[model samples]
Target: MPSTDDLKLRIEAAIPGSSAAVTDLTGTGDHFRATVVAPEFAELSRIEQHRRVYAVFGADIGGPIHALSLVTKAEA
Candidate 1:
């Protein structure tokens, strides 16, 4: 199981100019809620921005992280 810090790193690396706040939604380490802010998300649609964030985890999304709740925003 990946730690929340690990998840935050992966997202920050994947999303341009992005930072993340991750919460463990479950004790199993398979569920999380992440608040991500990035400049790359500025022009993106909500779903598209979400997809970009989701793309970071790839297979880990459903495996090590079963559920990922994402909150994406542009860098203000």
Candidate 2:
């Protein structure tokens, strides 16, 4: 089964120096919640920050991965 490792790697690749925490919201691969902190997020608005992370998966938002509740912040 595809695990968080795959998602983590993808996010890490999409945004370098980023750290993420993934939670299975429904015990299914679709619904998820992620807290992502990255140095690259500095100066970005909250909505923009979330968009950047969401864009990583492209159209997979409603496919392999479904709902992604994001808590994104710039790294301190």
User: What's the CA RMSD for each of the models?
Assistant: 1.1, 1.4
Candidate 2: lDDT over CA atoms?
A: 0.84
Predictions in order: lDDT: 0.89, 0.84
Report the C-alpha lDDT of model 1 over 10-57, residue by residue, as the tens digit.
998877689999999887788899999999788999999999989998
lDDT by residue for model 2 over 1-76, one digit each (tens)?
Answer: 3467777778888898999888788887778888899997897999899999999989888878868889998974
Best by TM-score: 1
TM-score of each: 0.93, 0.89
The residue-level lDDT of candidate 2 at 3 comes to 62
Give me the candidate number with maximum lDDT: 1
**Candidate 1's error at 25, in angstroms?**
0.8
Off by over 4 Å in 1: none
